[model samples]
Target: MSTAKDPGKGAEKAHGKPSAKTPAKPAEGLPAKILSKILPPAEAPKEPGEEEGEVPHRETAPAEHGPGPDLRRLTEIARALNSEPELRHLLDLILDRIVDITGAERAFLILRNPEGKLEVRASRSLDREEVKKPTAKVSRSILVQAEKSGRPVLTTNATQDPRFAGSDSVAYMKLRAVVCIPMIMRGRSVGLLYLDHRFEEGAFQGVDLGLLEAFGAQAAIALENARLLQENRVRQAELERSKEKVEELNRVLREKVRRQSAELDQVKQVLRERHGEMKLKYAYPEMIGRSRRHLDLLRLLDRVIDTQVTVLIHGESGSGKELVARAIHYQGARKDAPFVSENCSAIPETLLESELFGYMRGAFTGADRDRKGLFEQASGGTLFLDEIGDMPPEMQSKLLRVLESGKVRPVGGKDLISVNVRVLAASHQDLRKLVEAGRFREDLFYRLAVITVEVPPLRDRREDVPLLVERFLDAFAAESGGPRREVAEEAMALLSDYDWPGNVRELRNEVFRACALSEKVILTEILSPQIRERAVPRSLPARLDDRPLKDLVRDSVEFVERRAIQEALARTQWVKTETARILGISRPTLDAKIQQYGLEKQG
Candidate 1:
């Protein structure tokens, strides 16, 4: 018996002669050098006992009636095996082809795992159906011998052969015609090809072993190629998943940056608003008056000062509405622009249009050259229109159009001029009443009164009277270049007690007159007669005889209570909390007293 050699090394001779070459066409799809190693040349000399075109049968096995191995079929099978790249499918293909070529009852392709353990990768029967429980069908002893020696193990009759007689699988299954070929790659056994026939002793011959050894070499290469391709596919899938994760992270980062930028811009805007508020609080010293009403007006002015909304100032004549307008113009964003003022009542109806919107040079009686009007002059600044309630109905319509369109047509000019002016209108008369009586256009009134600022008259904030008096006294001294005159206590009391009907203007005029006449101290004698009349002490009731003692006492108590509550209300500026605190009473009790005494806050 001849020993089996490694299929990858070379094919060995059987029975002391070279194995007869299978006569068929040349192979394809493999390199010629590799094909030469796997297939015998067609022109080789025939064996002595072998006839032309006939396979030689060995002495240990009976002669077969089957034809010789077909070279063309083997080449086709090699091409088919190499073309398959998927590992699982290629393994089944290898086993199926082995069963067909060797005429074995069953075939198994066993491979080594990463841990170097033998595993049955595929199994096929002669019927071309898959065999289950392939591990039980394979001979473990044969597989070990083939792998260790790195050679093919062939037994014509495994049960009788001493080499495999002690194998449990061979004894139990009575295996015969067994062959185990080691699939070697790069001089290392990667796995083994196992085939067996259970019934016949010479089912596989020397000719079959030679053909299988050659086929095994091609199969090993195919198996290695398939395993590498599968690994590459798994790695490619992992890379795609990683790329998507990176893109998602970048998107989240961009969104976070955008939100942070917006929040920063909001913080900057808040800081700017706070800065503007600080400027309003300390910048205007002439706003004058610490009364709650005056403070409330200042707050309202601060709110509207930075905005470009039209403001309508509502107050009685000489209450200083124009002063409030000037404060807004000078202390606001448009402080660098011009401030133009006009009195709608002062200009006559015939000349008002030309005064407000300038006429073209040759269009009027005394026209000399084109002149810009108040609206044009006040561009990019503030325009104060005093006594707007007295504006004629026709002129009011034109003013409303200009204010809405932001463009005004001059008296005789054909083109409409655009003006970026912020308008502030003032009126002592109530525009609401004028609108109701049809003396003013309702639409125009609403348009002008986008924001309304009410300037309190001097009488409403009587607590400011002392401060105003001191200011006026200082002004008179500065103007006359004389020693500053001081008013007597009684005279100041009389001035505070008497309500000034003509408001601050009348008060200033009276102070000026007193300062002019007095030498060092201003007294009641120098004050106006109307103010002096209030200085006369009120006389007590001449007779208390008509009412009972208890009744009279009750009446006096009520009068004192009423006076006390009234004084408290005035001192606290009608703020119930302060009024109650000063009177040492609860808020509910103070409210009750105020209601009972018919005490109401005066405007």
Candidate 2:
């Protein structure tokens, strides 16, 4: 039969060349006897029905052989290709089926790699086994032409075909009956299927070319699906790893927060204990007295210290209400902040509002600049309003508003300023009575009296007199740079017996006056006239005849001298030298007198 060629454009004649005398080796996995039945011999004669030198028409052959052996085989091979999901197995299956169906000595499946170079993916022979040195056995020129044109190329006698005469692979391999079909998918060529026979011309016909092209389409689709499935599995594995890492990080974060919360709680506990110790050490250091009334007042102060409640202190005018307020502030948590004191009765009614609540520069006359009120100045601390009962009715309303809101509006200012001050209000007058009389706001009284501290008068705690007298004596001596003076028994008795209406303040003034005027000892003659006049009279015997006149005179003198000497010795702490120096006597005389009086130092 004459050689035939399909070079993509149309079929053409291939000049006849004598077939090679050497027979090609049979493919592995298929016996030589079986291959002999599939492929025609090199010099086989034509069948009786076939005319000499006649080639089958490419389009007409398929219609005439409808549902014939070749079409049925193509369908079976396509089904097999689609069933296989692994690319490696599918590639080998495709090449094996092509060699079996085409009756070619070798078949190669060439595909594009990542860099777009064609590489043989699967190579096989008719024996259904992989072929060795597949690239060297195939015609490179035919594969490249089919891939570039996106069409199939067929040559019945490649050695004699002028179209591939210059091709080195074709010349070296003496390739014949070569067919290369481009696998096209989505209107683009993806790869090529190549088949070739070595000794036979016209081994692959135009009908086989058409069947292989259809098979190439099915193989391309199967390969793409396998690649996509593999990519999805890899992505799923990565997502699972990321999820585990996120869960681990969340667990670590929760553990960290729990530890920090526990540490914070421990620190707060330590601060509370230290705060209690501070209160005991610093509260009311200057309030010196051991009287029951004094001790009771201290206990009340202790309950209110370290708290932010408003306190109302009630006592007479000189009873040291401001002093109690200071103790509350200095002993509390706000000790480092300010302690401001304002006497409600001391400032004029017209100026009290500006003085306590501040004012803007242009708000009133003589207002040179803006000023902070007592409330603002005492922010985060304490504000002591003494004689609160005497505050004007208008100012009382404003003060009540500030106490309720914890904020204050300065006079002539538009904005209200917030404050953190703890209010401490004190009054000598009875506030409940003032409220009953409509002189004070009852609501404000309740707010300020969340706690109440009542200071005792000097008359009620008479036992504290001796202690107060000594404190005042030492203070005066320190201030005046002079020797300390002692009060005689008669003078002390007179002072203690008198009712000090002016409270501790009156006693302090009395002692200061006596110390300034007296030298060595304070006698009754130097005592305040009010104290002396109020003293209980020294009783005279019913009659002087009951005792001798000389003995009465001597006993009175010795009694005064003995009391004075004992007091001097006690002030010196029983030291004879110091006692004699204070008394202006020799040390020997002081010892002799101590023995004469039979006086011993009491523990």
Candidate 3:
């Protein structure tokens, strides 16, 4: 036998002799370069009967049979088995490698079941019909003995081998050669790698057994790794399914909560409407009255309540102008619709146009969305514009156009929207006087005054004072949770004769004060000084008796100053800022005078 050598280190030179020291790399066209790196190349093929020193000829393995596994091929088969991550493919690959590496005619990869039976996991050269055969029964006894011993077993001629002399399968199948290797993992034998040749004896060699045993060990590791991978994949799939189920449950709960919240909001809106109706019924219980003047006023309201007439109400400040407007709206045909009211004097002249006619989005700063004005909101209803005389001259022209055409143009809008609103205007100022003075438009006044309703002052309706007093006492008692205050005969007489500059509103305020300060009785002492002082004037002397002339003039001047300050305070409802404005004095001067006069607040 010749020794193996690296083919890349040229053994022969151009001179037809073997080179001694210089080593040249193999030609790039050669396939044996990879094999050279793993192991020495096999010795060149020798001719028949050649001597040991004779030069050998290069030859390839015959096509009819596979060659034994070289060192390079064994490593390649091991890498291929380890690379496969799936258990099924790896098993087949292991069996294919066994057949190629050992030059066997058939190969079988057998695994031990839990019951200790050898089952065929993968096989080459076995037909599908024959694959069902029991591996332990068909395999010679030597395979079992080798697996138990945890080593490889080889036979050149199994039928006649001493180790398997009486083996039934060896004798019946006439097997000539066989190689069996145990697949060991973690110090235990799990299965066997089996190979056999029936066509030729000695087809597998000792060197081939070593390669098969090495490949068997690698196959075991590969199979275990693939099993772990499959288990991990199954666990991830279960977790994903569980996560999806939780998300679906959360979405269902949120939708249920949203529906419940909507139901609660609808209930709240219904409660608010019920409360407003209750308040209106309690405050205006059949229009508290007992006089013919009050009866005539209600009759006038009845005639205009059913029509679409534009009614103008003329009354002094605090004279129930808004009350008359509310009575007309709540008793009218459009009572179910909105009864939107705006005080023209309360809003600035610059913002009055937008307040009455609405505006588009981005009409000015802070206007982020389109808004509906009082006119549009009061469609199919009544739009009560209080203090209409205080509306700017420029806005008056626009109001006239809207009232005439029954259409309103919103601020910065190109379209006109039709409105079916009934306008009710009120003011303390005389609109006809304002028109004559060039401060108000004549056309707008005519549009508003189609029907005129004048609310009488409290002085003209003295017969209604006792009824108004009883109503205010009961209303205030219920609101304050106290006993109703009874008015004394003298207090009632004093309140009746007083010229109420503030009208019924002032009388109600006086009664409310008495209810807070008195005990079960509205006495004369609890009445406002304006009402008390009115009674004193009826008894004033025309001439002083036994008094100095200078002293009388000074006392009269002091009395007149005190009375003037009291009237100014009552007009402003005791607000220092407004009282100072009406009295044409600074707030400091008004404060000094209020202290110096020793005036006590009654209402």
Question: What TM-score against the true fold does each predicted structure earn?
Answer: 0.45, 0.44, 0.42
lDDT of 3: 0.70
TM-score between model 1 and native: 0.45
Report the C-alpha lDDT of model 1 over 305-338, residue by residue, as the tens digit: 9889999999988788998999999989999999
- At residue 152, candidate 3 shows an lDDT of 74
RMSD for each of the candidates: 18.0, 25.7, 25.3
Question: Candidate 1, clashing residue pairs?
Answer: none
Local distance difference test scores for all models:
0.75, 0.73, 0.70
Candidate 3 lDDT, tens digit per residue, 1-603?
111122222223211333354333322222231223222223333345866665333211111212222444655665686689888877777776666566677778788776987778777763322244546434658777887677677777787787787788788888887777888777777788777777887676433333455566667777777767878888888888888888888889889898889878646643543343212322345466644356568767867787889999999887899999988888878889999988999999999999999998888987888898899999999999999999999999999999989999888788999999999999999899999999999989998999999887776555466678878988898999977778776687677667678988898898888889898877888888878886543222234656577545654654455556767887777898898898789998777666544444542
Q: CA shift at 433, candidate 2, in angstroms?
A: 0.7
Error of 3 at 569 (Å): 36
* Model 3 regions lying over 4 Å from their true place: 1-286, 536-603
How would the candidate models be sorted by TM-score, starting from the highest? 1, 2, 3
TM-score of structure candidate 2:
0.44
Error of 3 at 557 (Å): 35
Instruction: Tell me model 2's lDDT, rounded to 2 decimals.
Output: 0.73
